[model samples]
Target chain A: QKEVEQDPGPLSVPEGAIVSLNCTYSNSAFQYFMWYRQYSRKGPELLMYTYSSGNKEDGRFTAQVDKSSKYISLFIRDSQPSDSATYLCAMRRSNFGNEKLTFGTGTRLTIIP
Target chain B: EPEVTQTPSHQVTQMGQEVILRCVPISNHLYFYWYRQILGQKVEFLVSFYNNEISEKSEIFDDQFSVERPDGSNFTLKIRSTKLEDSAMYFCASSEVDSLRPGELFFGEGSRLTVL
Candidate 1:
């Protein structure tokens, strides 16, 4: 089974709506979860980060992780046109030396104005 | 507001030829990493470097692939012999602390490699 699974969504939503993105993982060792935003032909930019299970909020973006279910989520409130991009869910173990991130397939989002 | 930077935004190289992608990670960051992404796939880890040595690598990072921190500021990934499957976008990233800390990693714009 793949380590991380995410819906490759070309999800479209109206502006000012609430957008939800989710991911599931098979690895129980993952202790760090993150959300990244990628523009067309650009690199992945860090959006939200959460440690283990719980929630983290940053302005309009919120990230939640549930270790027991191996599920993680990102919620965007008052979504704007500028928020249109591919959202990637990434995670990694708690190793101190080599902490390479494992990423999801990414979901493409579009905010219709 | 420092960020990682990669060279040769896009490169088209002939198969079997050698190619080198360079990156300048954020200053003061001690951990560095290389990741790859195909046209429609997820980002995969290639290798990680720390203290001028390779800390870890993925199975895809075989003998054909090698990483070198040639100097103080430059970290490079060299493909000794390129293959068609090697065509992908390579990203360089760096973080101030390890995963134990809350510090987030910063990524470069990425270098697109096209092997024909």
Candidate 2:
């Protein structure tokens, strides 16, 4: 099994709808969780970040990590068409200085107008 | 805002030919990395460099691959001989701190490699 697993979704939602994206990880040591949004032909842009099993909110985005299940999720509130992009879940073990980040296959999301 | 920039946005090479992909990371960043994504696949980490040396590398980063910070600002990934499987979108990333907390990384747009 892959260290990190995410559904390759072309999830379509209406504007102003709430969207939830998730990823499951098998690496018990992953302590840092992040969500990145990638537009077509562009690099992944950091959207949400959490250090442990908890929630962090920024603007319309929220990131939650459940260490017990090794599951992480990204919730988008009041979604907009501009939010259409691929969302990537990435994680890494803490303080392993210079350890590379492991990324899951991104989920493509489309916000319809 | 400063961003990671890469050169030769697209490259086409023949199998067995050497190719060097170049990147200039954020000036304040100290940690550098190379990651690749084959068509319709997950992004895979290749190697990480810090303090002018490779700190870690995945098994996929075999002897055929090497990295160098030939200058103060330029970080390059060189493939000794390209293979058919090496055709992918190569991304360069960097972090300002060594700590993995929150895992903040800045990535380049990416260089697409097509091996013929």
Candidate 3:
């Protein structure tokens, strides 16, 4: 099984709709979680990240982590057409040099006008 | 803001030829990294560098690959011999500190490598 799993979604929704993107991991050792936004032909840009099992809110985005279940999520409120891009979930253990950070396949989201 | 920058936005090379992809990370950053994304695929970690040494490397970063901090401002990834499967978009990134921010990793626009 892969260390991290995310549904590669071509999820389309109307503007102002609430969007929920999620990721699940099998490793109990993963203590940090992050979400990234990647536009076509561009690099992944960090959206937000949470330290552990908790919720973090930044602007219109919210990141939630449930370490007990090895699950994490990013919620977007009042989604905009500009939000159309690939959402990727990434995480790693506390030790920086022990291993390279792992990433999910990413979910493609498109907000329709 | 100061973001990472990479050279040769697009490169096409013959198989078995040596290729060096270059990057200039954020000037004040303490950590540097290399990542690649094959078309239609997620970005994958290649190697991480800190304090002039490789801190971590992925399995995909094999014997054919090497990294160097040849100058104060530049970090580079060199492939000894190119292979067709080596074609991908190579991105250079850096962080101001040592943490999970490789996610927020200030990435260059990326160099598209085409091996033929």
The DockQ leader among the candidates is: 2
Query: Chain A only: TM-score of every candidate?
Result: 0.96, 0.97, 0.95
For this target, which candidate reaches the highest lDDT against the unseen true structure?
2
Best by TM-score: 2
For candidate 2 chain B, the 10 contiguous residues with the lowest summed lDDT are B96-105
DockQ for model 1?
0.62
Q: Give the per-residue lDDT of model 3 (tens digit) for A1-113.
A: 98999999889999999999999999988887889898987878888978857899999999999998899999999999999999999888864543456889899999999
CAPRI grade of model 2: medium
Ten contiguous residues minimizing lDDT sum, candidate 3 chain A: A92-101
lDDT of 3 by residue, B1-116 (tens): 77888998999999999999999998988788998988878789999888888988999999999999998998999999999999999999887675545345778889999999
Put the candidates in TM-score order, highest first. 2, 1, 3
What fraction of the reference interface contacts is present in each model, in order?
Answer: 0.52, 0.69, 0.45
- DockQ (C-alpha based) per candidate is 0.62, 0.73, 0.52
Q: In model 3, how large is the Cα lDDT of residue A8? A: 93
Q: Per-residue CA lDDT of candidate 2, range A1-109, in tens? A: 8899999988999999999999999989898888999998888888888986888899999999999999999999999999999999999887556778899999999
Name every residue pair that clashes in candidate 1. none
A65-94 per-residue lDDT for model 1 (tens digits): 989999999999999999999999998887
Winner by DockQ between candidate 3 and candidate 2: 2
Compared to the true structure, candidate 1 yields what TM-score? 0.96
